[model samples]
Target: MDYLTATKNKKYLMYISQNYSYAILRPLQQEILAQGGEVKWFLEGNEVTSSFLKNNESHLLTIEEVIRWSPDVSFVPGNVIPPFIPGIKVGLFHGFNSGKRNRKGFEDHFNIRGCFDLYCTQGPNTTSRFEQLSKQYKHFAVKETGWPTLDPLFNPDTKSIYTQPDDKRKTLLICSTFSRNLSLAPKLYQTIKTFSEQGKWRILMQFHPKMPNELVTKYQALENENLTFIETDNVLPLLKAADVMLCDTSSILLMFILQRKPVVTFCNQDPGKHLLDVTEPEKVEAAIELALSHPAQLMDDIESFCQQLHPYQDGLSSQRVLAACNELVLTNPKLKPKPLNLIRNLKMRKKLNYWRW
Candidate 1:
């Protein structure tokens, strides 16, 4: 069977749970539409705002409607997807693995819960591990297709929302993980506030959607001529706008580093040569200064890290992902049956009120 032909007129469902999933999956949607395929979105959970859906986009309101539509494939950015949904489940993970660990002390990125038939990984760092798990489970396939979200970062045609300030000072993007134990927003608040008052750098602050409201309020209060608090579904523009980034244990730092820019992490869980990891809040300012200098060794380390993290800079990851999905659908390679996952499915059913088997 011709896989390329198989993709024509295909039906796809963008399974979204968080606001950021929009940025991650929209590139793939554009690619799907370009290939003469149909795309629809299914916004799950209350976290995703329905207003984000544009006038041109189509979305199903209920599971029954989703069943009636009967898509050929469902692309999920979040961890869970209902098995009852009629489609080949494909996991397009939300973010890179920035060494964040779960409550059980195990890395959360590599945890396979048997919810997907295939995982289109970001790069070698993730592909190799998922491939090993695929062999062990014999229930899924792994393909390294870079990340669809970063396609706009490299794509020249894509317009960025970022506009340069007239002052032309260096921009420092500050982001933090929501994890209470790993968050730097609280710890570095004073330091960042001082930086803003001094007006040495243009500060842009964005935080995880799940970050504490109190901390968000505090940061928002710091907004001044030099400091700005940003709230948006997509962070790609911010990544492109910043000259340097300050983060702590958040995957966004990894995304920023992919641009060959320097990042300063405050008490990062897994520090490496690529990052200027500082344990003390007082040292953060110095680290930012160092990162701005772009030392030879640090820049080289960042280059090496990017190659391992995500080598594809061609802005065609969406095409590659669609090709992978088409090949899987057309060929239908034999593989072990996926596990029942009774409890998880039960929870999903309860959440969606979808009882039909």
Candidate 2:
């Protein structure tokens, strides 16, 4: 029997994120708990052990132990053919944001890909793309709720943490993270040095998680009174303080686009490059240097990129996500469709060519 049938909680189950905060996870969880639903967490990664959960009172079970209990919804739930507890409603955290492959290319990864009644989405195009590719996957017409980590970006309290720079220097915030692929680092450093020589911009280097210690120290050693490298979680506050943002598409692009600031995306990753058209290396180098020298050109690039980059600016995407989840598990429930039906629907949608959007 489904655990909800017996325990009688809201029958909504949340898969825990290693990093938790009011940003995205907390609000949905708060909604769940407020409705008298039992909120359970599966502890596996650092997310469960994350200091963020220290004082909060919630029932947490290890991933291995969860097999004995019934799970209603999981973030990626159990890999394949998840232990289907009788009477448990099912849901999943949706999106494959890391890779360039569209919904069609990722079909091979799903063990029981079509089993969920509800699939929460990342944006409108993501919703349209998935529904076009898999008829069984329902993409509700709500705010294409953006990611949760961004919730703090929308918070009012977050604004006060920043201090505007002095009049002498225009701050250039370089947002970077540790990539197993280091090809882009040397070029990026070279580009910054070229700009700094002009003495028009102050460069602040932001390191990504897992950045090499040597790499951090190498840049730190060259510190111009104008150059500073920071590795903490204060990237957003830094973005607010800056005149411009330069990063290799680390979702910080979303933050800048939301703030309506100009941004330059580095397309250095191999498998997951940016989808939009990018300037060539010569064009890129010239643009960066020219923009740095002039700085006013940032407004033009900001406006240009906004056409393709800023679709999910609704800002209240979290609420739409919770509504979609509630509809699937609470208001209306459906069963997983057969893979054959899913593929057949995919084939049918091709004639409509809705995937082109």
Q: Count the backbone clashes (under 3 Å) in each candidate.
A: 0, 4
Clashing pairs in 2: 2-86, 18-47, 176-208, 177-208
Candidate 1 residue-wise lDDT at 297: 100
Model 1, span 162-216: residue lDDT tens: 6475768999999998988899987888899899999999888999999999999
TM-score of each: 0.98, 0.63
* Model 2 misplaced regions, further than 4 Å: 1-43, 46-49, 52-54, 57-61, 64-117, 136-143, 160-162, 165-168, 177-183, 193-199, 210-213, 220-225, 233-235, 267-286, 289-314, 337-357
- Candidate 1 stretches with Cα past 4 Å from truth are 1-5
